[model samples]
Target: MSTTSTPDNLELATTAREMADQAPAGSLEKAVAGSVAITCATTRTYQEAIDVLGGIQPVEVRRPAIEFLERLAVAAR
Candidate 1:
C-alpha cells in the first residue's frame, strides 16, 4: 500500500477481496478489476470490466492494470 491508502485501503482491500472471492470461478481477475473500477466510479452495482484487461500478456500493461485497480479500490473509500 502507498501513503494514500493507510487504513481505508486496508478495509477496502478486504472488502474487495471478499467481492473478488465471490466472483465466478474463471473470471476472478476481471471481477476484481471490475469491482475496483465500479468502486472508483462510485457505482451501486459492480460490473465486470468489458475489456480483456486481466489477461497475463505484456508485463508493462499488466503491472499498470494491477496498480490502477489498487489505486481505484482505495479511492473507492
Candidate 2:
C-alpha cells in the first residue's frame, strides 16, 4: 500500500465511499464500490481494485465499474 494521498486521491476515495454507501447490499455495484473504497481509503494503488473489477460478469456493472476504476487509477498515481 502507498501513502500518496493527493487531493485527487481524497476526492476519489470520498466518491467511492459514497457509491458504496448508496448501492444496495449484496449487489455487484456495492461490491465494486466497496472494493474501490477499500483501495482508495487504504491509500493503496488501484491495480488491486482493477484486477478484482475485471472479473465482474455483467456488462452493465463492468462498464461503469471499469470507467470508475480508470479514474481511480489515474488518481492513485
Using all chains and alpha carbons, the TM-scores for the candidates as numbered come to 0.35, 0.53
Among all windows of 10 consecutive residues in model 1, the one with the lowest summed lDDT is: 43-52
Runs with alpha carbons beyond 4 Å of true place in candidate 1? 5-7, 28-71
Model 1: pairs clashing at backbone N, Cα or C within 3 Å = none
Q: Write the per-residue lDDT of candidate 2 for residues 1-77, one digit (tens) a residue.
A: 34343344456678888889999999887877776666556554455555666666666676677677676656546
lDDT, candidates in the order shown: 0.48, 0.66
Which ten residues in a row are the worst by lDDT in model 2? 1-10
**Candidate that scores best on TM-score:** 2
Model 1, 1-77: lDDT tens digits are: 44343334345445556656776776746555544444434432222221334453554445555565555555664
lDDT of 1 at 9: 37
